[model samples]
Target: MSAITLEIDGNKVQVTDGMTVLEAADNAGIFIPTLCHHDKLEPFGGCRLCIVEVEERGWTKMVVSCVYLAAEGLVVRTRSDKVDRIRKTILELLLAHAPDAEVLKELAQEYGADKDRFEKDPSFCIHCGLCVRYCAEVKQKFAVGFVDRGIRKEISFIPEIAARECNACKECFPLCPTSYLQAAFVLTESLAFPAQQKKSE
Candidate 1:
């Protein structure tokens, strides 16, 4: 593939074609924070933590670097006062769901985000879709999926498939930002997959 040159935080980088700005920045040794991006999965851009400023042809706009395609002559700024403010707001929103997540805590410190900025919700999931996508894309299990929508949306395991596939393939558990995947799995085992639970016991 041909090379694409771009400027990330004043550092010129040449990356392979089809690489996203996040990947390009990473290869160039520039730090860009992200919550919903993983190398093994397609770009989901759910967390909005890798937002960056891109300027080309005298126009500037903000985009999630994980999904934004890298291009020749593109100018990217991973962090600016405006970028930090946006990230701080996103972190504050996520922190409300997972106040104790160490990853969020560290980013919150860097961006000055208050964990209590939003009202507390019992669900600790930030809804990054890591587990859902990993199970479907990488594992091909389709065991876990999303339920509901908008304000009420959350992840859930489909007990029929999960009961048979999850325990043996718990690879996605560690990808959770708040460790909520394990809890969700345990709850599903108790509530949705009770037949299997009783048999196992």
Candidate 2:
């Protein structure tokens, strides 16, 4: 594959084919905030913090840098009024869900996002899909997944398999930014596997 040249934050960057905008920006030493992205794991664009503005086909549009593939002659802006507004909005919303997450709080502070802008929710999961993707991609367990959609969307342990896999696999715990999975691991009875079920027995 041919190397592609693109502009990120007014700096020219060269990346190989099949590289995402996030990777390209990283190659250029540009920093794009992200929550759900892991270098070892696949690109999961759950958090919109890495969004960038690009001009494509004469139309300016916002796109997620983590999954948006880099192309030749693409002009990308990692920071701008529009990009900051959208990223701050996303951080604020995430704060509502994970208020106790120190990582989230710090990011909100950096972005000047108002954590109190939205009503607080009991949920602590940011729905970054890190745990889910980690289980499937790295752990190869496929023991957890997402359920429902919209605001109701949640991470659900695959009951039948979760009862067999989750308790032994603690790898995803450290990968979570919020450390919210610790609470879920201890509290979610419905997702309990044999090890947890033994506590009741």
Candidate 3:
């Protein structure tokens, strides 16, 4: 494979061709924070947390590092004031939508986000699509897909059925980026804790 040289955070590094900016940063020991991006799956620029400023041919633009292909002579800034603001805003929006999600909470904390300025709707999905992608790509089941559009978009197993031909694989649960598929588990645990405490009393 051919090699591509790029400047990441002002440090020169050479990586294999066809590598994404995120992969190159990882190879160079630069940590670019991301959500909705997993090493085991193909890159999907849903979260926008990995946004970086890249300079190419005298022009610079913010691009999601996970999906942007790294090229020779590319100058990348993994973290900047603009990138930080974008990440914080994205996290804030995600937290507002899924406030009960521990994963989202942790990510928000990392960005020092304390409050959401926007109205939160608990019923909507963040639309990361990790569940559907995992089922289709990783599990090879193709059991689920996105239905509807915009805020109405959601993952469904099939037509008119709440469950898909999932093969009982349980792969989607862990891979879900927004914890939508595991909300039941968290709720059940929270409910059980109170009852268990009463039982001990």
Clashing pairs in 1: none
Residue lDDT tens for model 1, 1-201: 999899999989999999999999999999899989999999999999999999988899999999999999999999899999999999998988899998999999999999888998758889999999999999999999999998899998898899889877799989998999999999999997777767767
lDDT of 2 by residue, 1-201 (tens): 999999998998999999999999998899998989998898988888899999776888999999999999999999899998998999888888888788878878877999889999858888999999999898899877788998898887766776666666778888888887766666564444545667756
Poorest lDDT segment (10 consecutive residues) of candidate 2: 186-195
Q: Which whole-number lDDT from 0 to 100 does residue 13 have in model 3?
A: 91
- Writing each residue's lDDT as its tens digit, candidate 3 over 1-201 gives 899899999999999999999999999999998767777789988878889999999999999999999999999998788888888888888777777777777877877775466787775467777877786788777656788988777666542222333323566777776567665333433454445434535
Candidate lDDT (C-alpha), each = 0.92, 0.85, 0.76
Q: What is the TM-score of each candidate against the true structure?
A: 0.95, 0.89, 0.82
lDDT score, residue 164, model 2? 66
TM-score of 1: 0.95
Instruction: Report clash pairs, candidate 3.
Output: none
Clashes of 2: 1
Clashes of each: 0, 1, 0
Q: Which ten residues in a row have the lowest lDDT in candidate 3?
A: 159-168
User: Which number leads on TM-score?
Assistant: 1
